[model samples]
Target: MATPDLRELYLSLVCLITLVLILVGGVQVVRHGLKLLLPDPPPPVFAPPPEPADSTAMLKPPRSYEQAWQQTERLRLQRQAIRGLLVNLVLLVLAGLIYRAHWRRLQIMRRT
Candidate 1:
């Protein structure tokens, strides 16, 4: 078996992340496209106003809540993703510069 090239692996990971960004952006585009194409659904045919539950029934808060750990996990993931994107962009720009620099070097070498 042959050893894998780390540089190639890194590039593939960056490409995958870029693909995910494109997919997310594409989904938003399609969602807006659908909204543009279709008329909004008419409000519920039977307009029933929200009713206050009887006190006799168990009174519970209607607000939704997330556990502290869950929120922390979401924040962690968001931080990780943002960091990954920033790093990937920097890598891409750096790679472009390296390629251009090397290409120019090669041209100079050939001219010598």
Candidate 2:
């Protein structure tokens, strides 16, 4: 049997690589989607009110600080999930496009 030409071989290799990339990207996107959809419930934050004191009252942190810290943590988690989702989506799309293009080229080469 005749050996495949270099162009065809290269195109086939690219198609395979791109398909792998697409699969990995798709998996990551799905994982990220699940993370966003069913995110772990944020742990409860509780801080007891400071006891009444004349001098130390000014030193004690307010209850709002605890609330603010919790809010910041939640926001950070949300941001990470969103960023992951976006990045994975971009990877999936680009890889899919590349795979399609290379597959089409391979098909055309085979037709000749």
Which candidate leads in lDDT? 2
List per-prediction Cα lDDT, in the order shown.
0.50, 0.84
Cα RMSD (Å) between model 2 and the true structure?
3.6
- Could you tell me the TM-score of candidate 2? 0.78
lDDT of 1 by residue, 14-87 (tens): 55565565555555545544544553433223223445766523343332323444556556655555555555
TM-scores for all candidates: the values are 0.39, 0.78
Candidate 1's displacement at residue 71, Å, is 1.4
RMSD of each: 11.9, 3.6
Scored by Cα lDDT, where does model 2 land? 0.84
What is candidate 2's lDDT per residue for 7-30, written digit by digit as tens? 999999999898888889888888
How many residue-pair clashes does candidate 1 contain?
Answer: 0
